[model samples]
Target: MTSRRTFLFKTLPAAGITLALARHVLAADPELAESDPDAMKLAYAADASKVDKTRNPTWATGQRCDTCELFNAPDGGDLGACSLFKGKMVRAAGWCNQYVP
Candidate 1:
């Protein structure tokens, strides 16, 4: 029963609103900081290459969050959610004691 003009007016605004909300919801989460108490305890480094080899003998040269089993990377992006740090994102090149191949 709606006219073409009325439908356009209603649909355009609704579509725009939906797009805005979807973008907000899908926005990337904040990155985890190494200075956090939990991160410090686990020796989490934003860059795997920066991790101290002497302190963590288990760490290998190529280990990283992106390749780790605990990382939940969507679309193979550079940032992802790590099981070690809930609700925060980790860099693809990050490292932590909990990292698994």
Candidate 2:
């Protein structure tokens, strides 16, 4: 019989490998472009500081993808996945109308 400890030990390596592969795949994804149709709708700015505050009154300085609640990039990653834009990557310093504090 496979003991609980034995099972955990056997699965741990595979789990680590999976995590590593996932990270690599994420890293390989292209960064979301500002001109992307969906990106245009949201007014995504690769650099949050570039957002036109005059037009986007609700926007406050310092709001960025990396700081937003939906930001899902791995720690220290400059670009990563976002829940809002499936299969696409957003810049850590980027911003959009959908930003959530």
Best by lDDT: 1
Provide the TM-score for each candidate, comma-separated. 0.76, 0.70
How well is each residue in 1-101 modelled by candidate 2, as lDDT tens digits? 99999999999999999999999987776878999998998888899998899877878988999889998877668987788888788999999999899
- The digit string of per-residue lDDT tens for model 1 on 1-101 reads 99999999989999999999999889857889999888898899999999999999889988999889999888788889998898888889999998888
**How high a TM-score does candidate 2 get?**
0.70
The clash count for each model shown is: 0, 0
| lDDT for residue 41 in candidate 2, whole number 0-100 | 86
**What is the C-alpha local distance difference test score of each model?**
0.90, 0.88
